[model samples]
Target: MANPMKIRAAVKDGVTEVKVLMSHEMETGQRKDSSGNLVPAHFITELTVVWNGKTVLDAQFGPAVSKNPYLAFKFKGGAKGDKVVVTWKDNKGDSRTDEAAIA
Candidate 1:
């Protein structure tokens, strides 16, 4: 299993701001190992964010993204104590889901 992602969500003036830090190697195939072998591309390909059961953000990523990606976003219509969920799927079929309450 991959490491748990760090997430923070806060609502202010009816807008919710979210920040996430995901832990992953995010290797690109273009890189090489010490033995001069190509590293397989391993990266998050899809990510989704939901608030109160409604989808707020849906995104796609590629190997170009840096390791341990950090994401920040804002959306309308969230309140304190609302549930915010985040899920990500990597190219290797590994997926992780986490949730937090709006503060």
Candidate 2:
């Protein structure tokens, strides 16, 4: 079963710090299920964080990352009411996008 993800962020002093928690099984394809079936590998492929319409932090990940992956990073040039967006996609092409406004 896949878990639900949570995202957190804070903007202060013109800097925005963001955290993302993505819920996934992250099967490595080498694993076997209780029924002895091979679990196909499925993991995060790319992740990006955008601040005020600009890409601030970008990353690539693989199956080794871990289940319920956690990502944290910092960005610059922001203030109250600014928008910060984070998007991530899995190897299977599944994706999710979320945003937070500077407070």
The prediction achieving the highest TM-score against the true structure is: 1
Candidate 1 per-residue lDDT, tens place, 32-88, comes to 999999999999999999987799999999999999999999999998888899999
How many steric clashes does model 1 contain? Answer: 0
lDDT of 2 by residue, 18-95 (tens): 788888777778888899998899988898888867899889988788888888887777787777787888889888
Q: Whole-model Cα lDDT per candidate?
A: 0.93, 0.80
Lowest lDDT 10-mer window, candidate 2? Answer: 1-10
The superposed Cα distance between candidate 2 and the true structure at residue 24, in angstroms, equals 2.1
Candidate 1, residue 62: lDDT: 97
Residue 23 displacement (Å), model 1: 0.7
Best by lDDT: 1
Global Cα RMSD, each model: 0.6, 2.2
User: Which regions of candidate 1 deviate over 4 angstroms?
Assistant: none
